[model samples]
Target chain A: MLAEREEQLEALLVEREVEQFLYYEAELLDNRELHEWFDHVADDINYRMPRRLMRENTASVFSERGYYFNEDYGSLKARVERFDSEYAWAERPPTRTRRYVTNVRVTRDDEALAEDELFVEANLLVYLSRGDSEKHTFFSARREDVLRRRGDTFEIADREIRLDQTVLSTDNISIFL
Target chain B: MAAGDKPSVTEQALQDARDSLDEGFFPLEFFHDENLHDLEMERIFGQAWVFIGHESEIPEPGDYARRYIGDDAFIFVRDESGEVNLLFDSCRHRGAQVCRAEQGNTSHFRCPYHGWTYKNDGDAAGIPQKSKAFKNLDREEYGLAHVPRLETYEGLVFASLAEEGPSFEEWLGDFKWYFDVHMKLPEGGMEVIGEPHRWVIDANWKTIADNFNGDSYHTAWAHGSVLDLELGGEETVGHAGTGDSLDRHIHCDGHTTSMRGFEDEDVFLTYPEGVVEDLFTKEDLSDAQWKLARQALSFTGAIFPNFGFLHFGDTTDDPEKDVAPFFTIRKWRPLGPDKMELWSWGLAPKNAPEEFKERMYKMYTSNFGPTGNFEQDDVPIWKGITESANGQFASSQNLQLNYQMGLEWMSEMELDDEWLGPGFAYSENLEEGGMRLFHEQWYEMLAGNDRTDATGTPMNVQEDQ
Candidate 1:
C-alpha cells in the first residue's frame, strides 16, 4: 500500500511537471527567447521533421528519406545564430508569432532505458503574422518528444515534428514549429 | 492588320513584350499577367520537354509517383515492361484523378469517384458494373491518356504534351554534357533521397527560373548572411566577389549553365577520392568534361521552361570536416500569374557510404533546403518582387525591368575557346546571357515559331541562326 501511494504521487508529479515544462517551452518560442529555449535541449538532441506524403492506405504515409530539419545541437545553434545576423533578410523585420501547445500526454519510458526519461506527445498550432498584413499563417503539427529529467528541469533529447500539410502553404518555414 | 481580323489586347501585349526584350528591357506586366500565364501553360509548358521525375524515383516495375506538367497532373510510373509511362491522372468515365496518392508501388490505379481502373502502363483494366452501365464500352478506347512524348537522359525523365517538338536530345543540346557531369556518380549514379519539399511562393515561375538560371550578382547582397556564414569553399565565396573573371556562364538553346572553377585542382576534394577515381574511370564523361568537372566548385542552370538544378560543394560548420558535394533538382510549377509552387528534391550518389550520404543531405538542408538560410532569403525576395510588380505603379506595361547587364560587354568578351563543352561560353559568371537566352526562347515558343521534329531539333534552328 505504501508503494502504491508513492506510485500514485509520482504519476501526479509527472503530469504536473511535464505540462508546465511544455507551457514554458512554448512561452520561450513565442517570446522569441530562442537562446533561453536552447538551454532546454539536451546536447545530443535529435530534432527532425521528415516529409509527410499522402499515400494509399496500404503504404505508410511518413518518409524516412527526407527531412525539413534533421539537426543536431550544433546545426540548430548555427541556424539560430543566423537569425541574429544583420543579413538574415528573411527575419530582419521579425514576424510576430504565437504557439498554442495542447494535448500534452506523457508516459514513462521502459525501465531498461531510464527511470527519469519520459515519452511526451503534444499537438501544436503556431500562428505567424509578418509584414503589414492582418493575415496569419497557421502551422499545425503532432510532435513526439523524448524528455529526460535533469535536476529540477527537463531537457528535450529527441523530437519528431510531424507536420500536417504536404505542400506547406506558407512562403517559407523560417520559424520553428 | 489583316482582313477581317482584330488581334486581342493580350496578343498585342505579348508581341509588345517580345519586342521589348530585344531592347534590353522586359515589361513588368509580363511577370504578373494572367493572360500570359494561361498562354504559357499551353505554349511553353505544353510544348517543352518538362522534367517529370528522375528514373531512380521509380526504379522497379509497378513503382509510380504522381507528378505535374504545369497545372495538369500525371502519373509517372514504371510499367511491367520496364518502360516509364507518363499518364494523365484523369479517369475517362467521370474525369476524376485515378491516382490520388503522391507515390506508391501499385500495379493498377482505381479511381475513387467511379470505379474505373487503369493498369500501370495506362491500359484500361476494368469499369465498375460494366455490363449494367453500357453495352459496348471499349476498354482500349477508354485507357488513360499518355503524354505524347516521354524520354530520359542519364536517369532524368522528361515528358512533352504537344504532338510535335524537337527530340529531347536536340532540346538538351550542349546541356547534356554538363548534366552528365553533375549526375554521373561512381556506382549507381544519383537518386532522389525522398519526396520533394514543396511549398508555394507568391511569385511568378519566371522570377524563380531567372534567379536560378544566372543571378550570381544577387549572392553578394541577398545571400550576404550565407556568405557571412562562410560554409562554402573559397571558390563559391570568390564567385560572389565583384570581379569580372571569377566564373563562367554558358548558354545554349534555352538552357544555361553557370559555373565557377575551384581555385585549385582540389575541387575533387568535395567527393571521396575513391568515389571520384571510380567515376572518372567508369563513367562516360569525356576527358575535357572530366577535366572541367575536377576544377568546378559550382554548377547551376535551368532547362528551358521551368526545370532547374544546382550542384555545389559546401563545407560544414565543423572546422575539421572537408567540403561535401550536394545536388538539388527543382521545378517551378506555375499556380497562377503571381504564385508558383516550388517542388525541390535533394539527391546524392547512390553508391556513396551511408555516412557520406547523411553528410551530403545535412549540408544540402543546412544551406539550400526549404528552411535553409539561403532559401529563406530567396523565397521572401521573390514574394517581395511579385508584390511590388502587382502594385499600381509597377503593373503598367510601360515600366520595364532592365535585362541590360553584360549586353555591351558580351560583344567584346569572346567565347572561351578553352571550354569544349558547348554553346556560347562567356568568361564572366555574372552575365545576363542566360536570362537573355531564356527570354529569347520564351518569345519563340510564345510566338509559335519554335517547333521541333522527331529528332527534337527545333524546326527553325538553321533559320534562327
Candidate 2:
C-alpha cells in the first residue's frame, strides 16, 4: 500500500512538470519570442495542422492529404525567421493574442512513445485582436504533442493541431496557432 | 436587375464608369456599393461563365462534392454512366436541401425532412408515401433542376446561368492558346492534388480580379517577405520592368496572362530533371506552345469574371530545400459587396511521381493559399481598400483610383511585335493595360452590353509605331 502511494505521488509530480512546461511555452508564444520558442523545438520535429473537414454522420474528419502546415525543422525555422524581415507585413503591426491552455493530460505508458518521450494533450483557446479595430477573433483547438524529456525540461518533438473550425473566419491565419 | 428590367445601378453611373475606364480610372465607390453589387450579381455572374470544380475532383461514378456559384449551392456529382452533373441541392417537394455533407459517394441522396430521394444523376428515384398521398405527382418532372449550361475544357468545368448567349468556345476565344501551356504541357495533363483551400475574407471579389488581371507591379513591394526569406527567387518575384528576365503581359480575348522567362533557355519551370524528362511531351502542344513552356519561369493569369491561376517555379518551402514548381488555380465568389469566398487548388502533372506531386502541393501552400507567406499580406491590404471605400466620402467626392500606369500619356508602353501567341503582348511587364481591359469589360456588362464590345484594340496598341 505504501509503494502504490509513492507511485501516485511520482505521477503527480510529472504532471505538474508537464503543465508548467506547457504554460511556459504559451508565455513565450504570447510574448512573440518566436526565436526563443523555436529554440525549444527538437531538431527532428514534425509539426502538422491538417485541414479539418465537415461531413454528415461522422463527427471527426480531416482531409486525407491536405494540410495548412506540414513542416520539418528547416521549414519551421524559415517560418520563424520570416517574421524578422521588415517586409512581413502580415505581422508588421503584430497581433495581440492571449492563449488559454487547459485540460492538460500526459501519458507515459504508450508503447509507441520512446522511454524519454511523453504524449501530452491539451485544449487551447487563443483570443486574437488584429488591426486597429475593436473586432477580434478566437481560435479553439486541441493539440496533441510528443514531449521529449531533457533533464528537467522538455522539447516539442512532434505536434498535431486539430482546429475546431472547418471554415476559418479570420482574414488570414497569419499568426501561429 | 433581379427586381425588374431596369438595372440597379443608374445609367448615369454606368456612363461615368465607361468614361473613367476610357481614361484609365476606376471609381472607388463601385467596390462597395449595395446597388452595384446587385447589378453585378444579376448581370456579370448571371450571364458570364463561372468556373466550377475540376473533373478530377469527382473521378468516380458516385463521387460528389458540394459547390457554389454566387450564392446557389450545387451538388457536383458523377453518375453511374460516368457523366458529370451540377444539380441544384434543393428538394423538389418542400425545397429542402437533400445533400447534407460537404462531399461523399452515394447512389442516392435522401432529404431528411420529407424523405425525397434523388439518384446520383439528379433524377428523382423515390418519394416516401408518394403512391398514397400524391398519386398524380410525376417523379419524372420532380427531378432536381440543372444549371442552364455547363461546359468543360481540358478537365476544367465552367457553368453559365444564361439560357442563350455566347458559346463556351466563343467566350474563351484565342485565350485558350495561352491556357493550353498550363493544361496540356504534361503527357497525361494536369490533375488537382487535393481539396481546395477555402477562406472567406472581407474584401470585394473585384479586388482579387484586378490583382490577377496582371498587377505585376505589386509583386516586389507586396510580397517582399517571400523574397527576403529566399523562398522565391528575385526573377520570379522582382520589380516589374527592372529584371533582366524576359517579362511580357499578354491580353487575349478579355483574359490576361503575364509571364517571366529566359530568352533561349529550357527552364521547364525548373521542374526536377527526372519528372521533366519522363512526363513532358511535345505531342499534344504546338511548337510555339512548347517554346513558351520550355522558357517559362512563371505564369500568372486570370479568366474574367473571376478565375485566376498561377504556375510558378524557383520557389521552396525552406531556403535549404531544392526549388520546385507549383501550380494553383483559384476562384473568388462574391458573398457581398464587402465579402468574398476564395477557393484555391494546387495541381500537378497527372503522370508525375507521387513524391513530386506532394512537393508541388507543399510549394503551393507555402506561397499562395490563405496560410501562404505571400497571400497573408495581400488579404489585409485588399480588405483595407474595401473599408476605405465604404464611407460616404468616396461616393460624395467621386474618388477615382488611378489605373493609368502604362497609359500612353503616363508612360511610353511598347507592344511585342514578334509575339507568337494570338493575344497582344506588351514587351514590358510594367504596363496596366490588362487591368484597364478588365474594367472595360466590367463596365460593358453592367451597362447591358456585350462583353466583347469592350475588346477593341487598346489605345496604346492602336497607335501608330
- lDDT at B4 for candidate 1? 33
Q: CA lDDT of B237 in candidate 1?
A: 49
In model 2, residue pairs whose N, Cα or C atoms come closer than 3 Å (at least 3 residues apart or on different chains), thus clashing, are none
Which residue pairs show backbone clashes in model 1? B165-B452, B166-B452, B166-B456, B167-B455, B167-B456
Please identify model 2 stretches exceeding 4 Å from their true place: B1-9
Chain A TM-score by candidate, in order: 0.92, 0.97
Off by over 4 Å in 1: A1-6, A58-60, B1-9, B238-246, B317-321, B409-414, B451-465
Listed in order, the DockQ scores are: 0.66, 0.75
Q: Residues B1-465, candidate 1: write the lDDT tens digits.
A: 345322223876777677676566877767776677888898888888888898888989999999999889999999999999999999998899888788889999999987888999999998888998866988899999999999988788989898987889988877787788777735577888877888987788888888977887777677767666665555564445344323788776568888876544757536767667654443577877777777777788888888998888755643335667778898989989789988888888887777777777777777776787678888888887777666556653368888776665333444566767776677766567678677777777777777321123222222234
lDDT of 2 by residue, B1-465 (tens): 244222234668778677867678898888887788888999999999999999999999999989888988999999999999999999998999999888889899999898999999999999888989989998999999998999999999999989989999999999999998999988899999878888888999999999999999999998998889999999999899887898999999999999999988999899988988998998888999999999999999999999999999999989999999999999999999999999999999999999999999999988888788889889988998998877777777878999998888888788889988888999899989999999999989988899999776886667654
Candidate 2, residue B175: CA error in Å? 0.8
CAPRI band of model 1? medium
lDDT agreement with native, every candidate: 0.78, 0.90
Task: Give model 1's DockQ, 2 decimals.
Answer: 0.66
